[model samples]
Target: MNIIQKTDDELLEIAIPMWDDLIKYSNKGQYGKFIRNFSYNLLLGLNEVEVGKQFAKSELTRSLSPDYDVLGFIRRGEHVSCLFRVRSTKKEGEWLGRMVLGYEKGEVKIFAASVF
Candidate 1:
């Protein structure tokens, strides 16, 4: 559940589960779970982020895809961040998911998820 001790390969493993869970929850009509993945700073009733997650969730027919690529990890001040680049074509056009994770409170959690 944490990435502090995780190597690059371990971090990549974490991202896959995150991606699978998001798609699973979204497909089950659990948008609330999707919204809860965000960090504290990003909040709103309806906005770009929420819509994008839901849209991606809705469009994803498979739980996980081979199109996902880990964009690597970097330290940003007090936080360590990881990015995963994802591509899916279950819809009319190509979709990209830039999923992000930030290590905080002794655990790595989904801090941001955006798809376009």
Candidate 2:
């Protein structure tokens, strides 16, 4: 992985927040802003409602909803692999999600994501 020479503070304060914003917009059902952060394929087979339902992101705005933390990312050429920790008080209290990001047309977009 070709790591980006950035401070944790920068990743936390800048890069990570960008991904967080994607989820925030997703949870709010704002397809325009939400879809902009994703890569082509991830956005291709899904619509706004499906994206919300599939990710269970619609409930993310609730006070008792799970918290998402961007652990970090490893960059390889134009690809960036991100790790996130999802914490909740429910039965599935803690879990991990992996996001594969890549630079396409000069934009860093999430190409894939999966719960682990």
RMSD of each: 4.8, 4.1
Evaluated at residue 99, the lDDT of candidate 1 is 61
Q: Rate the local accuracy (lDDT) of all candidates.
A: 0.60, 0.60
Q: Which portions of model 1 show Cα errors greater than 4 Å?
A: 1-6, 43-90
**Candidate 1: tens digits of C-alpha lDDT, residues 26-93:** 55556677556566654443586656565565556443344566667765544446655655545444
Q: Which consecutive 10 residues in model 2 have the weakest lDDT in total?
A: 57-66
TM-score of each: 0.57, 0.61
Top TM-score hit: 2
Instruction: Report the Cα lDDT for candidate 2.
Output: 0.60
Candidate 1 colliding pairs: none
